[model samples]
Target: MASFNEDGLKKKLDDLNMSQQSIQTVSLWLIHHKKHAHAVVNVWYRELISATDSRKLTFMYLANDVIQNSKKKGPEYNREFGSKLGKVFDHLGGLRLDDKSIKGLNRLLTVWEERSVFDADQIRSFNKNFNKDHSKEKSKKRDHSKYESKSKRHKKDVEEFEEIASEPRVRRESELTEHSPQDSTPPSDPPEPEQLIEALQELESAATSDAVVREKIASLPDEVSDVTLLNNLQDLNAARALSQKVEEALAMLEVYNKRLAEEMEARKSVARMLHDYIAYQKDLLAQAEETLEEHRQKQGKVKKVREELKAHLQNLPDISKLPNIRTGGLAPLPSAGDLFT
Candidate 1:
């Protein structure tokens, strides 16, 4: 029986391998673009499957083999590799294009991130290419006036600076002996975006720029045109907000748990006290009944007529004091077992 089960298991494993190979073949065909093929596969499996299975499973096995084989072929075969592969998928999936043709292509190429088959260097290279290509394409679309405008702005700035230098300087009282205020001095020019940008660019281009100046310019906040910079700031802010919210939630949960623990302890204490009180009452009742039995044993039974007559004479006054015979002739007495029962 065990041999039969083992044989069946081996056959199943073989079938799974065949299925996985078939899937990979279809996947490669579906993924028409070689640039993002590996990335799509990695992301589709990585984020979508459990880690242990990812490494051992036959389906992922074929996908992993394909990526490794592609990497060996050439640098051009490198897609967004590694964990970052998932991010590429995330970016593409977020696009709002509802066109059937575009959507179908996206669906066909859809894959999640898989960490097992990741290659970091390949991803870096991919990003470098993507950025270079994107920048080139954007430059091609822009007008020549954009570059010309920069040169014109620089010329105007130099002229303005020369004009300012030609004007007389305004001197304070401390330097009155050497110079005096000149009304001819042109009004100080207010700073503009173009001026700041030009200054920063010049500093950046210089071979021997001041470290402090470069740091200050680089660290200065960006404008709308620098989407990456703005996005980084927004992401930072969002992370901070999420962290604060998580901390607040954890604090509230801690307080609730503490209150619950205190309530549970109080209830336990009350239960213990009630249990002890009931046991003490039972002990006291038992002692009282034992004492009553001892007194009866010491008295013994009445024997003679004279003793009975004497007892009757002794009880005559008490019996004659009854209120009404019909209403109070007999008050029911409980048996010995009634006390505990």
Candidate 2:
């Protein structure tokens, strides 16, 4: 229920980091306020333009996360970001980026293209704009390297392009393997409060919220458990019908019990996550308090030193009140003989 505005958005961006959790947290915040998608995208683009080169890619990752994840929720973010990406690429094309940054940007573009995040024509347009400068640089390199054999040069160029193009596929595969629940190790960082809340909300009715199912469970016939009632069965057909009813009741109860068990496990997982997250936060708070105490001590020492210096200065003769001696009125130095006497 947190409200979103331009200032809050900027503050979030200013603290944004490359960690997946950090990116996802901010993305969730933005998507939670999808009603302001237009303003959010505009602010996002503006910040991206002003961000240091090191942080620019992080901003793009955030955008990617929001646009892709918000699609199921609504098209607002995707549409808003889509409308601005061409200009974003154009701005990026003008910057003097290192090879790594260039490669990262290329990989993002590749992801968009492969996933059809935008229409083919729009993506093509974005690529053309983004790579305009890079293409020129490559052309110049090709021209300057005319002394090299054509086959060798072509091979080198192809290899470089392939390396960049193949990275997303390799990364995707590694991520899939890394994130498999069966193989996933505990995350190194604590879960954010927002993440824990979202997780708990998912389990709010995980055990089964069907009123009909609960009602059926509550009204289960006593015949299901009353073995003595078998004496009342007048024929094989009656016995068979009662037996089928017992089997059906058993099946329903089994299914509901399984659901309840799963829900229990889910809640336990969330509890573990919350426990870890709270411990982490408490540790951080302790560290912060220690730092504050250290700073307070230092400030006190500095203030004491300043006061002593001020007192020393105040007790000294004021230079301004002292008579100013002209060159002719100044006392002359004594001779070495006078000093001995």
TM-score winner: 2
| Error at 200, model 1, angstroms | 75
Per-residue lDDT of model 2, residues 136-255, tens digit only? 676665687553564454455444434323332112435533443334333223555788889989886786766788899889888898888778989999889988999999999999
- Per-residue error at 296 for model 1, in Å? 7.0
- For lDDT, the strongest prediction is 2
Where does model 1 exceed 4 Å of error? 1-239, 292-307, 310-341
Q: Against the correct fold, how does model 1 do in TM-score?
A: 0.18
lDDT of 2 at 208: 70
- Tell me how many clashing residue pairs each candidate has: 8, 0
What are the RMSDs of all candidates, in order? 39.6, 9.6
